[model samples]
Target: MSTRHILLGLLAMGPRHGYDLKHRHDERFPQARPLAFGQVYTTLQRLVRDGLAEVEETGSDGGPERTMYRSTDAGARELADWAGSVTPSAPFVANEIFAKVVVAILSGGDPAAYLAAQRASHMQRMRELTAVKSAKDADLTTVLSADYALTHLNADLRWMTTTADRLATLTAEVEST
Candidate 1:
């Protein structure tokens, strides 16, 4: 996720303090990993520097001072453009597991065993995600996120099987190198 753009999007709602932005982000996109306080401030600082956001107010309520930020006109346009732009399709093979399999074969290790173990790991995670998706009490956003993950994992399992089926050819190709 684009943290900068997300921050801008949040500011679009209204001026918000840094603390509010982090909590709001967590609530809004539960699927994403939580952001750190430092990251929040750092990104906000950069946004302010880049003319995308600005401190609209500064005040203190008997404790630490708070600075509320709002999106600049440019920030709104950039956020809208980012929201509308099509995300380029990432290469399916551009993943650690694929690289691991290739490296294991290149290093003269048994790719079959590696593939088996990796497949088992993927299946285990899929079961966990499925359980999350199946939960009746799950938040709709969380359930949808789990479903998305499960779908990708299903595709990965299919690829694992295909790669295993062609392991012999793959082994030969690696040996030739």
Candidate 2:
């Protein structure tokens, strides 16, 4: 995600200080992807360096002095363009267990145990996600999307298990050659 663009958009909503931006970001983050304070501040620095945000002094009496930020005209233009663009979805989906199983098999080690553990974990996660969907009072569109994502995850888990089984069998056969 373009944290810079996100920051710009947030600032465009109204003038905000770095602390306020971080607070807002933390509130908006999903449970699956939490935002860290460090990340929020780091992105703010980058935005300042890029001239996308300008610092200002607010006379509001809110305890200590706060350095407020306002999005520049250039920043607003960039934010609009970014929002309008339809970029392809990210491709690097991290499945650490799946990757580790592949590595163990390639290294001539037994991957059966790891693969089995991964299957159990993945299925458990799928069940949990399904339960969340059922237990929530979300809109129909959101529930449908969640169901689709859960199904995709389940399919990927099945594929990983099948691939691991084939690889283990093939490795055993190759060793006997």
Alpha-carbon RMSD, each predicted model:
3.7, 4.5
For candidate 1, what is the total of clashing residue pairs?
A: 0
Deviation (Å) of 169 in candidate 1: 7.8
Task: For each candidate, give its TM-score against the true structure.
Answer: 0.82, 0.66
Best by TM-score: 1
Q: Candidate 2: where are CA atoms >4 Å away?
A: 32-42, 60-62, 84-95, 137-152, 168-177
Question: lDDT tens string, model 1, 1-177?
Answer: 799999999999999999999999998788899999899999999999999999999999988999999999999999999999999987655888788888987898888898999899999999999888788888888888888888999898898889998997866898999
Question: Which run of 10 residues does model 1 get worst, by summed lDDT?
Answer: 89-98
The lDDT values for all models are: 0.91, 0.77
Itemize residue pairs with steric clashes in candidate 1. Answer: none
Residue range 35-102, candidate 2, lDDT tens digits: 57688778877777888888776665868666788898888999999999999886876677668876
Candidate 1 deviant stretches above 4 angstroms: 168-177
Best by lDDT: 1
